[model samples]
Target: MNLETLKQGRNYCKSLTLNDRKILEEMLEDDFYIKFHELFRYMIDEDLKLEQEWFG
Candidate 1:
């Protein structure tokens, strides 16, 4: 996604209830977090690469 989409996602997450955010944080502490972290990193790297290709 683009920067605007990422910002929207952040806003949506911020809009979540405190308890929901806490639960999400707890979920991120599990083994699945590693997989998700890796996936997110890869996606972000890809997005940056594409942006550079188009703009730079």
Candidate 2:
């Protein structure tokens, strides 16, 4: 997973209106939510690891 892509996705999410965010939150509660959440977390963790390796 590309960190830049993740950052872009996060920026897009942050740009959403309150109602849009609420709708997205509801959608995320569906059956695939756990898998999606896991994948997102993995990507973030991987990105953080890479940043630490590069900067430390």
Decoy 2 TM-score against native: 0.35
lDDT of 2 by residue, 1-56 (tens): 34455454542332344564454456457766655655445443443222222331
List ranges where model 1 is wrong by over 4 Å.
1-14, 38-56
lDDT accuracy of residue 10 in candidate 1: 45
TM-score of candidate 1 versus the correct structure, residues matched by position: 0.34
Write the residue-wise lDDT of candidate 1 on 1-56 in tens digits. 45444443442322344564455456557776665554344344433222233332
Q: Candidate 1: deviation at residue 42, Å?
A: 14
